[model samples]
Target: MSGGLAHRWDLSAAAAIALQKSLAGQVERADRLGPGGRRAIRHVAGVDVAFEEGGAITRAAVVVLRRADLVTVESAVARRPTRFPYVPGLLSFCEVPAILAALTALSQRPDLLLCDGQGLAHPRRFGLACHLGLLADLPAIGVAKSRLIGAHAEPGPAKGDWAPLMAPGKTGGRMMRIGAVLRSRAGVKPLYISIGHRVSLRTALAFTLRGTTRYRLPEAIRRADKLSKGGAPG
Candidate 1:
């Protein structure tokens, strides 16, 4: 895939923060998934990263699956030295380099990306998902197992139930709905769903629910997580 946005990954913490704040403005919250709505999403890719050698090395994995059947179509993995320290609200700087390498290795580009991290839910309103989506110029959604920056009420205990995730807005000192807490499986803890780039919250939630099956995570992300952890692909 083409590198949609260009920036040097090696930077100081202050520079990184500044870069994130600048890029956050480029994030388009509107839906750009194209016609046919959900059906337009034919191939969905999941991105994840894992650490090795006491966090000295990063193993990033990208797994693309057919949206209709959730079968793996293409997969790639890349390993690189860990360049950045683990910092809250700055995970993209630590992980995105290796993830971009893995993505560049893919022969089949996906229609949508399901990132294993936050999106607009971050403190700077730019998370790993948003960073990757903007860099790849693809529609992406963040599917996180935990919250990063948002307040929300618990969703219902059943599948398909959801509650709004709110954050303080810049104007009027009001609370803004940044994302949603969605229960992908019945009786399971909800997953945090947020827009990454070029996708709407509703479309992101729908795609996330469609990608999930027996597990609490979406199938593509689950497989990518396993791959990143040194497990063989299913």
Candidate 2:
């Protein structure tokens, strides 16, 4: 990780919030995955963390899959003590240390990262995905099963339907479009899609739908989730 991205993880809730606010400005929402405006996503990695022993230990997993065939390319896990408390918006601080370890263990870094948490759809606009993307300096997207912040209408029951996620502007200003509510599978709850870093929301959604096959979650993320839960890597 770069020195600017790798900062103090041990912080109080107030300090963490301040850090988030400061770093949020560095998050780039533009598409940076291609050479010349073309799709260049080849490998996508999913990241997740699980707590064990009464939330005292964290098991972080990262699974990389080939975008064309969805074949597992690399997988890694890191276990460490839970350093930070479970604050609502500061989840990255609690989980990212181990996640970085797992990423470092990989022989090949992925082109994109898919996090099982919020990105721009956050109160301070710096969620776990955003933090990881910035730290890793890779194009990343957040595919959360639920919302962390923002409001949106329910999408259609069919797969691929989506609605815009809106939040009240800063300081009670106008409404702001943050992310999207996307139905990844037919007749299932929608997933929250948001820009992490170095990717546009549209490209993030495209990559997400392409990565998803028979399940609501993307294939890479499914594998990572399983690994985090002590299941064998895919």
Q: Local error of candidate 1 at 125, Å?
A: 0.6
The best candidate in terms of TM-score: 1
Q: What is each predicted model's overall lDDT from 0 to 1?
A: 0.91, 0.89
lDDT of candidate model 2 versus the reference: 0.89
Residue pairs clashing in model 1 are none
What are the clashing pairs of model 2? Answer: none
Model 2, 1-234: lDDT tens per residue?
Answer: 432567887798999999999999999999887422246777889999999999999999999998889999889999999989888899999999999999999987788899999999999999998999999888889899998899899998877889999999877879999999999989778999999988889988888898889899999999999999999876
Each prediction's number of clashing residue pairs? 0, 0
On lDDT, the leading prediction is 1
How does candidate 1 fare on TM-score? 0.96
Clashes of 1: 0
Q: Cα-based RMSD of the predictions, in order?
A: 1.8, 1.8
